[model samples]
Target: MRKMALVNQKGGCGKTTTAVNLASCLAGKGRKVLLIDLDPQGHAGLGLGVKPDQIEESIYEVLSGKIQIIEAIKTLEKNLDAVFSNVVLSAFEQVMAGVPEREFTLAQGLKEIEDNYDYLIIDCPPSVGLLTFNALIACDEVIIPVDSSSFSLNGLGKLLETIQIIQDKAGHELTFRILATNMDRRTNFSNRVVETLRARFPRNCFETEINTCTRLREAASAGKPIAEYDQHCAAFLDYQQLMKEILREEAKMKAKGFALKSFVEAKEKVKEPMEKEVAFIIEAPEDAGVQIAGDFNNWVPESLDLTHSHGRPVWQKAIRLSPGLYQYKYLVDGRWVSDPSNKKRADNLLGSTNSVINV
Candidate 1:
């Protein structure tokens, strides 16, 4: 099973929007999807047409050991099931404080139901508190909802630091990427924010930027995923493409035999290679430009421009160079950024690491 969490420490960034839509889209594609509402606000359930009072048991009950996780899961349309959230869960931190192994509570509870679905979409709260921590520990991967706004990038450092803490205590098994939501191309500010994000979190970003649309809100108010509500809508189409990109990335990570520890190691490993042709299948944020530059290129930061697949954002390019290892990063919209796809990374003078990939 591929468990993914939609998280953002900043509110109104569309974390729940992505989770609800993506989970519904996967279900529409005939895949079993479980939407876990880790947020105490219970917006996910409301977005899914499920009333909080209607749910007899919730994630709170499961975490508290009052009920089994499987029992808390409420099946919705086709292959979609959701474990609704309730306001009572807001007290989770205080209640779970004295308990040992608090981080693994959600993980242990999810073991029984993980394999039952192809996708488990978790809608995390705005704050990265205990609830978000549990979701991080329980999930296999995370999709960060970065609203195309100026302040979005400012919170990244803190979010990453929290992830580091969780990695130290729980386990370093989770991978994450930025999923730009509420993107408006008509506005110069929006475009600049996207550019900044591309430059900042290169490898950890998705290749699809979800375009803002009124249909998204309409769909949510109607309590349905975009795919089910209106597949022709731009928002729905963007999310569908994003889902495909995520599946492709997951496959690549699995093929590389990456797990939690080794993956992080791979992200930090950067070295000169002895191969003449270095083929890099880089996973970059959608619409971000990638180029090669290093000692061989005198760190010009733009020696080779990477090309994308025709009509697709998944960037791929092959370069011919001397037989030695090189350090490089993707240039997304003129902003230099590290590659999050590869596990091997090497720190540069700028205090950021260039994700290393073996030739």
Candidate 2:
């Protein structure tokens, strides 16, 4: 099954809204979908018309191993099933701390029922914590739901950094896409933020934007996706466009291959001194000097100073490393940061992160 988790460290970025409506809209297209609410807030279930009191067995129970997944999976409607959550999920992190392979708890639970659905949509909580990690471990794609507000914009970098950390620990990288949510198309500020995002990450941002609509808010209150609540609204149309884009992207992913960060596995590596040149590029607008430090050059940051990349707002350096896995990080100006494009990463002993490259 195809899996994606709507995640953002900052709250009120429409994570739950996107999860509920996106799942519903995909199901509307006759694809069987399972909406899993990992947020303790239970907003996804509520939005899907499942009352909190009505949830006897929830995701909390399944993750904690108190019950099997089949017991928690509830049929919400035609072509759609739901695994709800409750406030009790808030304590799951502390409870699972001593458990073995804690990060894979949700993944292991979902494996049993994965074949039963075409898609599994996860609504992650607003914090950077274990629950979010569980959601990340359980899904292949990480869709960052961001509002047009500057607060949400600023938090994007931190969230990206955190994902890098999770990717390294998971021993696999995940592909991420940005979804602009709650955008007020009529407002100049909102339009500017959308423009900034498109310019900043032109290839990673989705063309479809979720607009601010009173009908969408009413649909949430009415416990339904906008498609089910009112198909004529702009919200439904926007989601329809998004669904189309997602399906197209999924088709490409299937044909091209799964994009696991660097797409290199240890066992899959064939020994050949096939030294190929690759340039690591970064957009460091105001930085005076940008350097890269990795195992290919004794981890010396000063050994590889990147030059300007063809007058673009980027710094780049080319290296000929043997076909294998390598981990590195960028020294931009004075601050060190992971290569934002390379999602595979691991934490360094120096309290920073190293971006991974498989070549």
TM-score of each: 0.72, 0.76
lDDT of each: 0.75, 0.79
How much is the lDDT of residue 359 in candidate 1?
37
lDDT of 2 by residue, 167-276 (tens): 77787756678999888877887887786566445445889998877888899889988888998988889889889888776565555565422122311342255789
For residue 117, give model 1's deviation from the true position in Å.
1.8
lDDT of 1 by residue, 82-127 (tens): 8999899998899988898897889899888766877788899999
Cα shift from native, residue 108, model 1 (Å): 0.9
- Residue pairs of candidate 2 with colliding backbone atoms: 168-345
Whole-model lDDT, model 2: 0.79
lDDT measured at residue 84 in model 1 versus the true structure, 0 to 100: 93
Q: Per-residue lDDT for 140 in model 1?
A: 63
